[model samples]
Target: MRFNKELKNIKIYEAGKPIELVVREFGIDEKDIVKLASNENPYGTSPKVVEAVKLVVDKMSLYPDDSMFELKKGLSNKFKVKSENIIIGAGSDQILEFACRAVLNDNTKVLMNKITFAMYEIYALQQGAKVLKTRCYRHDLDEFYDIYKKASPDIVFICSPNNPTGDALGKEYIYTFLEKVKEPLVIVDGAYMEYAGYKDEKKRVEPKDLIDKFENVLYLGTFSKAYGLGGLRVGYGIANEEIIKNLYKLRPPFNITTLSLKAAVEALKDEDFVNDSVKRNFTQMERYVNFAIQRGFEYIDSYTNFITYIFPKEVSSKELSNRLLQRGIIVRDLTGYGMNALRITIGTKEQNDKFFEKFKEVLNGY
Candidate 1:
């Protein structure tokens, strides 16, 4: 049985451990588990989204609207983009796959931050394209441009309010970078963009402004974070009609489920709910910051729903993660990313309190 040679180089992406897995592994009660690993909305989805989904339960027998008319219209209004400028996906990552498939080839090269989303390199490798990284861990546009001027890669990814790290690129910096690069297709993966926008006005990367300004840019957004619909898995891309049209050709039919479409549509109408969730997230986030400060630990200033606490070289991040896991508190260990750190999602007040309690107990061992 032969596989593509690229498979040998591609490492599987590891997701956050689930509550059920911990229960089975450690004999912990499900209720005791507080999962802050996946960056999910600790408050859950909007009530209106739930009610709207329930109304569509019996309709699952039929296929979803592949055209995605209503959801597209809602997004069009929200982002001020035309329907032709949009393409929906199971997650923002799928649109990323579409973008990769549409452009990447064996001889092509893709560039991104040294430590951004794992899926960026995964998708690029799937198409046999070479992957390039900036010298720094975060998004450094000057370094990216230095590579861009030399490599002239086909696709460039910028994950604003980047995953794992939680820092965001400023609006002026992004616009300036986009202005310099015209040939390569720049993918701005704004999965946590809502949280960034809420935290600081200058950090917001408006898709409307991006598309209106440059045809070479593709902006990705998801219902997963602030909208609290991660399980529903509905995401969309906004770009020039040409880029969107090319991506649409690669999209499978009826990609999003019936309930997902309804849920996303209803989720859009409840802006107040999303706004309230973002507000509450930051309030809880401060507690984590203070905890890090009081403990003499270092952490990155974040604009997203999660925070990454950096550990000293002597401390074992793996052991800390294992200790927390034993206590039924799930947090992501960045060991896989070659960092001695842990990325923790800011949970609800009650959940965050529990994490601090268990986390303190675990840290005492070190």
Candidate 2:
């Protein structure tokens, strides 16, 4: 059977290689690999979520609640939005695709930053939308406004604590953009929001606060990051009831597993666990930033669990990553993200220490 031309042109996203895959490819042992690639909580899921999953596994033969009533209710209580305004998906990634499908059609223009999440570009391409990508900078809303004024895109994706770069846009910029762009749908991808530091600080902006003010804004969140439920793949989207209704129209039934939904519900209740994860992330990020400073490596100030830094010009990121791998440390080589940089996920204290030791050795030409 022949596939559609759009499907043919769709490029699959390349995630960081899994430990098993790397071990198989390089003939290394599993225990030796340090995977700091995916921005996962190195300390796994909370005991509460783990227990919930274990309880739900007994009913694995049954299908999940397609309506996702309980999960939606939990999210509603947590976010202070009505249950009708929430849409659950396998992951926030699915919700992103749903937004693309619900709003974008052929000839629809889309605008996003040049170095934002790669998935946004992929989705835009699949939807046959005209995608305009601007240069990367911290909260450069003026550039986006200029593009929006010209393109009048049907959709705009903004990732707070943006992926690969790990910087966030300010609320004032968002409010200004919202005021200016009335024609487009603004999507705030906050997959890393739980790790966003200084909730009361001047620079930080929480999309949840702006939800009531902007009818066109959609906030996407996930349990995969701070909750350490990446393997379960549960995420959610919060928007106005109208937008949620349109998204639900295109979303498939039972897109999320019963176990995942149950686990995510419990994950939300585990406030202690979430707080610990956030605290650890903040501490580790600060440590890493200091390390980078002492080593004279250029890096953006990060507000998320992962830190991205430019390797010295004399040393290639790919080469450095390869060397790290040989020494049982794994970090992301961001060549595909159009930079000679490496992104290291913050792990447990011991893991962070081990990684830094290896990193220092690598810098010293070990």
Q: Which predicted model would earn the best TM-score?
A: 1
Deviation from native of the Cα of residue 229 in model 2, angstroms: 0.6
- Local accuracy of candidate 2 as per-residue lDDT tens digits, 43-122: 89899788878887988989988878888888888778889888998889999999999888787988888887889989
How many clashing residue pairs, candidate 1? 0
lDDT of 1: 0.95
lDDT of predicted model 2: 0.84
Worst 10 residues of 1 by lDDT: 357-366
Residue 256, model 1: lDDT of 93
**Cα-based lDDT at residue 54, candidate 2:** 88
Which clashing pairs does model 2 show? none
Q: Scored by CA lDDT, what does every candidate get?
A: 0.95, 0.84
Over the stretch 198-293, how does candidate 1's per-residue lDDT look in tens digits?
Answer: 989999999999999999999999999999999999999999999998998999999999999999999999999999999999999999999999
